[model samples]
Target: MLNKILLVCLLFSAGSSLTCKWMDRDFKQYSESALALLKTMKTNSTNSIDDIEVDDAVAFPNELYKHASKESREERLSFVAHVLDEIYALFEENQTRASWPENTVDDFLDIISQQANGVRRCAGKQTTNHHKKNHRKMSLYFKRLSRHVLEHMDYSADAWEFVREEVRIHLHKVHLLASS
Candidate 1:
């Protein structure tokens, strides 16, 4: 009788596992969504630079600065500088990431410059396909990213400006795509 009961228990566990395997499709869908973004980025890092989601890169800095700015000027500057360092470090990280192509400074600038006006124009053109509410959300997300950059970093010549511009525009494009 014990042997029969054990066999039944094992069978029940196996059936549950099989059921879970079937239910796992939802998890796979999210992963596939992420991969689709990766594929888009990889294929058009130059064109799609506008499409990469970069808000995650600046999120911590933005939140930290929001509170730190209430403190002394020194604390604010400290937070800002730290934010700059964190964003700057992302370039090296991208080197390891598969989707980002061989990005030159020029390619970065080309994509970044297309963002500010291009986004609003694209939305306007997409009026038939998109609604105003969704565009507003996309605008807000881009605003958050832009405000983060404006608060934390300065735009001067050299690698910093190139990278900053690229990041700003890329985040905006990503926001636009996400809302759609």
Candidate 2:
């Protein structure tokens, strides 16, 4: 009886593992597309600093960033910085689009820029306590900025809730991986 129970548990675990992998397949595809779009935008922004694409290019990267290994944290950090750079550039172009004052946008951008610099500084180095701290700090900054943007960007309440959930998931992943 014990052997049968152990076999059932193992099978259940394997089944759930496969189910999760299957469910993640679609999300993974979406994330890949988002990363590609962000890369193109990053390249375009490099060529013409004034012309940043206005879409939510950073959306998919959150998924990828959540799953990235500790060894690749630097690259992920740079990826995040590039995403923020794009968003900040867009803010400069679309200041009139937001209902909020220019100062509000500037405040968020300033916070993002500081976090970006911290991430850049830690890039390509062995992970340390400082790197973890930087990630945590950046995660908090990102959540704040995301909430503000979602609210001001004309998204519906449901959309804002979706974004909030995404931010929660990403921050959870960041902290979880930081400990590991």
Candidate 3:
């Protein structure tokens, strides 16, 4: 509990201390779209499952794949598995609390599984054929996950704000890379 508090404090301090404007415009655009979807989920509105926008999701995985030269094939696969595992855990933990239709929940899990399979299939390959499609899945998964968190998690206001800011930072970095 104390650690979470400290982490949130650190994130808040770090975010406030940074005056970087290089990625502001791109970050604003990216965060706004994602945040809009998240807000719909928060209100339990009827949003299309296809409303998941993952346009900025490809940058990190592409970066990882490109920089895998120093690492062995096994290492790269392990990294991908680790990421998938976290997503899986988050899905399992929050699936019940989301209160979406049963079909929607099941469909979301199917998408998650497909994403995992795609990562496994391309782990050590030169090309990521599922890059764009998997990114869309990732974005959808995040919306559902955030909805669960917003509705069920016991995070304080500051902590929730910190999470949003963390996402903003991540999207900003992804945008910077994608733009360049």
Against the true structure, whose lDDT is highest?
2
The per-model lDDT (C-alpha) reads 0.37, 0.44, 0.42
Give the best candidate by TM-score.
Answer: 2
Candidate 3 — worst ten consecutive residues by lDDT sum? Answer: 19-28
lDDT of 1 by residue, 114-164 (tens): 332232322222332223333334345445544444333332122233344
| Candidate 2 clashes between residue pairs 3 or more apart in a chain or in different chains | none
Query: In candidate 1, where is summed lDDT lowest over 10 consecutive residues?
Result: 121-130
Question: Per-prediction TM-score, please?
Answer: 0.26, 0.36, 0.32
Kindly provide the TM-score of model 3 when superposed on the true structure, using C-alpha atoms: 0.32
- Number of backbone collisions per candidate, in order? 0, 0, 0
- lDDT (C-alpha) at residue 138 in model 3: 47
For each candidate in turn, give its C-alpha RMSD to the true structure in angstroms. Answer: 17.8, 14.1, 19.6
Ranking by lDDT: 2, 3, 1
